[model samples]
Target: MAVIENVHERVLSAPAPAVGRLIDRLGSDGDPLWPSPTWVPMRFDRPLGAGAVGGHGPVRYRVTAYEPGRRVEFTFDPKIGLRGTHTFELLERGPESCLLRHRLVATPVGAMRLLWPALIRSCHDTVLEHLLDNAERVVTGTVSRPVRYPLRARLAVAVESVRLRAVPVPEQAALLHAALPRPDLADAFSVRVPPGVSADPQAWADGIFRNPPPVVAALLRLRNALVTPLGIERGDSSAFDTVARTDREVLLGVDAAHLDFRADVLVEPDEDGTTVTLSTHATVRSRAGRAYLAVVRLFHPPVVKAMLRRAARVAVAPPGPGARPEVAVAHG
Candidate 1:
């Protein structure tokens, strides 16, 4: 086993007690220092104190010691094989200043020994630095220099976004359920909306339709070309009409000679974060419709997955001055 120790410290222009208060609220509902919405949040079964169990993301640990506004320590779960402890401490430097520090002492066993230096360490270092930046921003009203996510960290987040799952259409999608009482096909795919993104389903739907990826755009063009010959309507933004909408869900679809299709976009909020589900329903009206459905069924999953993933990425990104205008959804 190889032991790896890492430490990060920052001097805040605030009193030790004030800085320590932030530590006490590490996993609380309105945490001002954990750098969430961009990364997995810190959470515990109860609250922040000795014996409280929780961890961020895939890392699991239990609080072993707590000193309220001074220091807190966590011991890793043995099953993870990264045997060690990590802690946060506040040291008073002066009447109006303090030093905040975080340290990780772990011995990686088996495969983690190799994985640590290559991947985990970079992500760990980045997260900690961002935490410190958050502390500076909250206590001092600004960060001297905010930490930009490196390529590796951005890549890690992108890869993690791809881990979506198929799900039954949510109850919130009442509009879709009513529209397709017994459709020829019904399927849903869901992904967690990253922390800090808009909870409006319209925002998520715009991400899916307004600026689709190149591959998805090409596929749609080919689809339109193939279907136009058979008198089927093209699936484009202009063809879609918002049939029904609420704050949490929006239903959009198009009708054609061969079939009727609708998509339900629903945003559900939970403790972890918001989850955006895209549920699609289709009703075939003829033999040509059935043949089209057969071919589409094969490509539906991947296309929907790609579209949802792109929406998630767009939803989390910081908007610029020239950001695209949001797509409008009709009321009622």
Candidate 2:
């Protein structure tokens, strides 16, 4: 038995699972031309049943029913503010294409429902378009280009091993600090923190003693060479994605183990030149993952400062688009 039923689905040339995930994830941000109200770093909460907020701070309910890479239903609750669910499902047609359906049903408190459905719909479509465009780009090989390499680093990988010398300290830190969100690390994809918890240090201290400590974040650093021999971009996370066995480790940031990580590269132009930083962090299970960051607390100020400087040096690279700047260690 269905209440208010509205059906909307799109069929793509892409596989069903892929279309489902891409569509479901694009909820408030599916339309390419419009800005998504649920951008990852800024807006949008997963687990549709999760409550969202209005501009000021009114609770919204979202209930998501999804089957990965298939279909998604995002239902918004009016009792709360912009509450809704996002679901995804994939139906394999043959070997190539699939059907993708994404729905958003909102229960607007009495009158507000009529106020903003169109605006919400616009944002949703934009994100969906972006997903298709990105998928096309990848399939067409317009993305995933190789990095610019130095004759030395390039030759060493393509030919022989190059001797390692000094560690580039200042350069690595700057790169990490830029890639990693130093100030708002806790603001990442967060689980609903019950009705009474908070983001304060004192609250955190009390939380640990009184109840269970939710996963905060795992802080870490990594370094590697991506010479032709390694067939990788220097310190690229793509380098590890091809691994066969995924390591199993508890989320407490204690023991170091093998992991699959991606490095986000962000370049900022300055009066001097350009600064590039690689965003690196732990990708443990969401629950245990938060505990994994406990290890970062061990770093002293001097150590932290040193790391930042190293990343900075890496971030501020040399001039010239074709030129491969001096090789420096890339830290997380």
Candidate 3:
């Protein structure tokens, strides 16, 4: 096996003490610093210190060394193909400045050997950049240069992105009213109920809206994770407060706080099936908003697509064997 190391550094405007507090907060439960939405939120079993086990998602590690207001190191257990130590250090630069550095030294074996160079490395780079930006923001009150997803990442987002699903309009308008996913959230909702379930659109819509589809809930979690860091407001029912719902279509608007723009989701029946299209038509009011939107646009489609697929699974699924007739829901 060969050694792999990545080092990222940033000069913060604040003193070492303030910067250190931010670093120490990483991995602790409820830590204010949120990583990029693409990565799992950092978590730990106990306080952030020596011997405390922590990592993001399935990546587990133990704090091997700790120095309050100075440095900390995490040594990850070997799993699949990764074994390494990641260290963070604060170096006082001046009376009101400090240099924060993160270093990852690891050896990748087995499948990880190829995976590291192929995928993890790129994502790690982006995450590290985001981590640095977040650290500086706590003390500087702004991130002058936000990180953007690389082209490779953007391409991946495009490849797996979900599009509209073709759900046949129920024979009765009431069927559509009932089967539709909740429109309260500024997200795309699609579902096809089994024949046994009430086909009335109103009934389906009422029940669906009462308890958001699992996929929509999961999507909201990711949405919150991404927008909270940027200080953007997440969409709620107010997104549709101004829209009009008709027997054939539902028109709603969505706003992204701090970004100074609005998006709309158009739910209408096409000749083939119902089509839900999410479109943003507002001019970005600020430079910062434009930059932020540019970065997030790549992620938006994939999120919508995933929700559609999930909705398809839930809406068309049989309650029991031969409980009801299955309907064909195709992705458009």
Question: Highest TM-score, which number?
Answer: 1
lDDT of 3 by residue, 196-299 (tens): 22233332332333245576677667877876666667666565343445554333344454443333334444322343433333345456567666766666
Model 1 stretches astray by more than 4 angstroms: 159-162, 193-197, 286-288, 316-332
Residue range 155-240, candidate 2, lDDT tens digits: 32222111112222233333233333332122111011111112232222122212211221112223232122333223322332
Output the number of the lDDT-best candidate: 1
RMSD of each: 4.1, 20.6, 19.3
For every model in order, what is the number of clashing pairs? 1, 58, 14
lDDT (10s digit) by residue, model 1, range 1-332: 55788999999999888899999999998788876665777899998999999998778999999999999999999777699999999999999999999999999987788878788888888889888988887888877767667777767766653357899977779989998878898999998854555677876777787777899899999998888888777776854567889988888887777888999999888767888899999999888999999999999889988888877765554212222212232111
Q: Model-by-model lDDT, in order?
A: 0.81, 0.32, 0.57
Query: Candidate 3: TM-score?
Result: 0.51
TM-score of 2: 0.30
Better of 1 and 2 by lDDT: 1
> In model 2, what lDDT does residue 36 have?
16
